[model samples]
Target: MTLDPEDSKLITLARAARARNEAAEGAAVRDETGRTYSATNIALESLTLSAVQVAAAMAVSSGARSLEAAALVTAGEGPSAADTAVTGELGAGALHVAGPDGVLRS
Candidate 1:
């Protein structure tokens, strides 16, 4: 079946996430939340996101990626133009994360 852009994106994200998770599992880097994150860690987290969770994760990850990309740029080690373009297209902005928390009774 042909998928919408969102679905296509989600599928790509899911596949990438699964691959990253597998790599991380092999490396045993599953509990490094307080330490330096491996590339697998970052990729896995970003890829494993569902369409529903994309917004929040993207909000945080997008900022982090931007910061990282900027640092790389300054250090003369930034991603190539194609990388930037692809990453820009995949920013968390593509997800829907906002919704009502709950209904309050008066």
Candidate 2:
């Protein structure tokens, strides 16, 4: 798979967030204005959230009205339904999935 520079950058940011948090997953998203948000999964005794959701929330909180693209770096199968929903609501055509090594998955 070929990634544009922006997508590649998103993957890099997601991977770095995962490594820094030592979490199960990491995700990044770019807003309509080209600002980016990245985050690792949030896990707690009472609540758990996927990295994609957290990244989306960050973008919303930061005043982004629409999404340009989204990427998730994980060992799991693919983006979850909730992840897809968030991207969809923000106007992303699709969610990009990549492995920890930065390889785009099928």
Per-model TM against the reference: 0.24, 0.96
73 in model 1: Cα distance from truth in Å? 32
Model 1 pairs whose backbones collide: none
Candidate 2: C-alpha lDDT = 0.92
| Candidate 2 displacement at residue 2 in angstroms | 0.9
In model 1, state the lDDT of residue 102: 12
Tens digits of per-residue lDDT, candidate 1, 18-95, equal 355543211101111211112222335446522222322343453433212100111122234543443354342221
Candidate 1 ranges with C-alpha deviation above 4 Å = 23-55, 60-106
